[model samples]
Target chain A: MAILKTENLNYVYSQGTPFEKTAVRNVNLEIEKGEFVGIIGHTGSGKSTLIQHFNGLLRPSSGKIYLDGKDIWADKSQIRQVRFRVGLVFQYPEYQIFEETVYRDIAFGPKNMGLSEQETDRRVRATAQRVGIPESMLEKSPFELSGGEKRRVAIAGVMAMEPEVLILDEPTAGLDPKGRELILNQIKEYHKTMGCTVLLVSHSMEDVARYASRLLVMNRAEVFCFDSTAEVFKRSAEIEKIGLSVPQITRVFNILREKGIDIADDVYTVKYAKEKILEYLKSGGKLQ
Target chain B: MIKDITLGQYFPGNSVVHRMDARFKLVITMLFIVMLFIGSNTISLEVGFVFTAMAYLCSSIPVKLIAKSLKPILPILAFTTILNLFMITSGMPLFQWKFIAITDEAVETSVFMIVRILLLIAGTSLLTYTTSPVALTDAIERLLSPLKRFKLPVSELAMMMTIALRFIPTLIEETDKIMSAQKARGADMDGGKIKDKVKAVIPIIIPLFVSAVRRAGELATAMECRCYRGGEGRTRMRQLKSGAADYVSLGITIFFLAAVIFINAID
Candidate 1:
């Protein structure tokens, strides 16, 4: 079932001014429930604007956004309810952390939802653990933590709300490889355990290829393609035409094929490419 | 949503007003304000109005932008109109009720006040619309350089103004982002009791404050790394100069001011 959807959605920034720009245009998208979908695009392709619409942070200039078969904007007064159901973590979320301590910051979302103090505390601790924030650091000021730790706490702030659909815009941005992997693994585990829809907006092709089951590609304020991970990677030439690239491993396979070697062209992730190479060699597959 | 603010926003253009020296424009805008108050009668204010309209046309800024800048003052306009209409009872009574009176002089005085206020806003807004903030501060620094002998730190003050103006759009964009981030977390910034509304702002304000301080620190560090000590011994890429056009513009502005003074003297 489609849990979050946008129908013919359009958004324009600073309309009626000289600086006016159409950030998102006539985008019709459907995100199924409990699916791990990765959204990829070059900068200024409306990835940020599109996700803001999903959680009611931005109202579309035209068309509608439906959350769980109901128009989220149908009742403006109840928009906050929609927000709690669809949590959005923005880029550089660490800058939004302002509470005296990590625990209070993570509990902010739950408290806004009017949860009891005890329940809010419980969720805060659980989310902290999930995001790899230690129990000892929970009492420290969020501003004092390292960049990676602060980022995890900020992510935990939204996770504590336990929304039905979580949309994170560039969650792994400005993080080291290990930090990125740690956060991505936590998100993957959260999706597995919570069974909630997850939409990860990213600029890195390898990160999404390793995790997301489906991919949505955007270009020039429009949906370029939306399909399974392997299917999207298959159109690497088309993706490249629009200033985006497929995974390095997939490009390597494509290059090997072009060099007169027969290799699996669908290899997108490093692990899958390794398995395919070993299997082909054991089967006595020879270069052309 | 915060982009609706039109005040102090510069619109790039190549009109005569845009090309005029900023220091000259600043002084002329001041003279224009003074001229507005010097005119006592409706005819005098009308002259001031005509001059402002001509300046607006010369600036080439869209009429809609002027209307937008006037929108925020609508309440003041209405309040003054009502106040003047009911308070001034010197001339023939146009309308009279139990405790309210509207006279011919009231009508004239209200029109004069409205015209004077509108002209004041339009004249100043034209200056900002045509001149960039950087040039404005540079002009201010040069104009106030005479006061530096009294240890007024004129250059430093102008440098502060320049930095403040530079960060306005950045700070506005940051505030918008932070508001959205908090709103997504269910922070109710709109539609609540008075106390609840104030409380809701805490989330947004606290984050905005934190980020603003961080940005300031980063800016200071960057400046230090670039060997910025102070405004002392600093040279500008584009020096403020008064050309022949500036002198002509100043002459025309003085002529208008003299016209207003002549009208006041005749009245």
Candidate 2:
């Protein structure tokens, strides 16, 4: 069954005012259970607005969202329960850290879920360890931690919820490459172990191509394409025309193809590109 | 939801009010506010209302926006009306009860009080709606330039105000983003007891404060990197100069004030 689904969703921000804008329009998507989906879009492409609807942070201007085959907004009073099931880690997640200790911060979501004290503590410690925060550091103030540590704490806060679907919007934004890799690797491991749906929203094409099985591209407030990562990269021209570029490795492959190289043009990550280049060399750089 | 705040929002336009010198607009708005209080009778208040209405029309701002500007002050208006209606008991009682009376004078005073406040807000909002904040700040600095002899930090004050105004929208945007992030964590801000409601807000407020302080530090470093000193030797891109329209508008405002005072004197 589809763990999360949106049917003809439309969202107009600042509606009925001079600044009114149609942020998301007629976006239909069904995210299957345990799917690692990557979402990519240019700025102002309604990616943020679309993710907010999944957790009931924003009610659709029109249409509906269903989680586990049930409408999220069916009962207005049950909206808070939906947030518990769908955890969202926003961009600059570190800025959302508030509790005095990193441990308390990680426990925040589970506590709000009304978990028992022991259960909350167990989940918080386990999540912190999963995110690479040492036990000694858990009792320290979150504000006293380094930027990357604070970020892990913030992400741990959501992961401790054990949500059915975890949505992260630009989780690696403004971090060093090492920090970014650390965070992404943690998320990838969590998806693998928890067997939960993960929607990774990112501007980095390389990161998404490596991690996500499928890609959802947004352009001008509508879904441009939703397909396998390789299939979407096959139409790199159309994606670029919509003001979003494919991964650097994919671009290099496209350039090689334009130069009359008889190589496959769907390589989206460095690892895949390296393998493709080696295969071409082994085949004497000629088509059999 | 915080985007609905219309306070200090400037609407870009080429209307006469938009063209009027900001310094002149500032003086006229102050005079208009003074006139609102100086006027004692219905006729004087009516003249004040007409003057404010004319200014509003000249600004060319949409009616909905002007109404939005008035929305924030609805509580203040209610308080003023209630205070005037219940406190003024000198005249004949229209409805009398034990230690509570609605008097003829009380009814008349509240009417005038409400009208004065509505006109006050409408007249001042016309200034903000028509004039951009940068121009307003420039006019303020220029107007206060003469106070340099008294060793007052006029330029510094204006610079602080400009920074404050510049960051209002940024802070509001940050607040919105943080609130969404916390809400996504299952932090229930609504549907809770009073103590729980306050506790729920801590998640939102601490992050907001942390981000705000970080931004301030970043801004300070950026300013220092750009070789920014105090406002002493800073040159302006657009100097405030009065046109013929500014003088004409100032003349009309002064004349309106005089007429109101003159009528009040006769009454």
Q: Which one is best on lDDT?
A: 2
**Tens digit per residue, CA lDDT, model 2, B197-227:** 8988888889889888998999999999988
- TM-scores, all candidates, are 0.97, 0.96
* Per-residue alpha-carbon lDDT of candidate 2 for residues A237-280, written as tens digits (9 for 90 to 100): 99989888888988988988888888888898888788998899
Q: What TM-score would chain B receive for each of the candidates shown?
A: 0.97, 0.96
Lowest lDDT 10-mer window, candidate 2 chain B?
Answer: B183-192
Residue by residue across B1-267, what tens digits does model 1's lDDT show? 587888898999999989999999999999999988888887878788888888988888889899999888899999999999998989999998997889999998898888888888878989899999999999999999999889899988998999999999999999999999999888888777999998888888898888888889999999999999888899889988789989998999899889989988887
Candidate 1 local lDDT, A1-288, one digit each (tens): 699888999999988877899999999988999999999999999999999999888889999999999999999988999999999999999988988989989998999999998999899999999999889999999988999999999999999999999989999999999999999999999999999999999999998998899999999999999999999998898899998988888998888888988788778998889899898888998755
Task: Give the Cα error of residue A122 in candidate 1, in Å.
Answer: 1.9
Instruction: For model 2, state the Cα shift of residue B226 in Å.
Output: 2.1
The Cα RMSD in angstroms, rounded to one decimal, for candidate 1 relative to the true structure is 1.5
Residue A169 Cα positional deviation in candidate 1, in Å, after optimal superposition? 0.7
**Backbone clashes in model 2, listed as residue pairs:** none
Residue pairs clashing, model 1? none
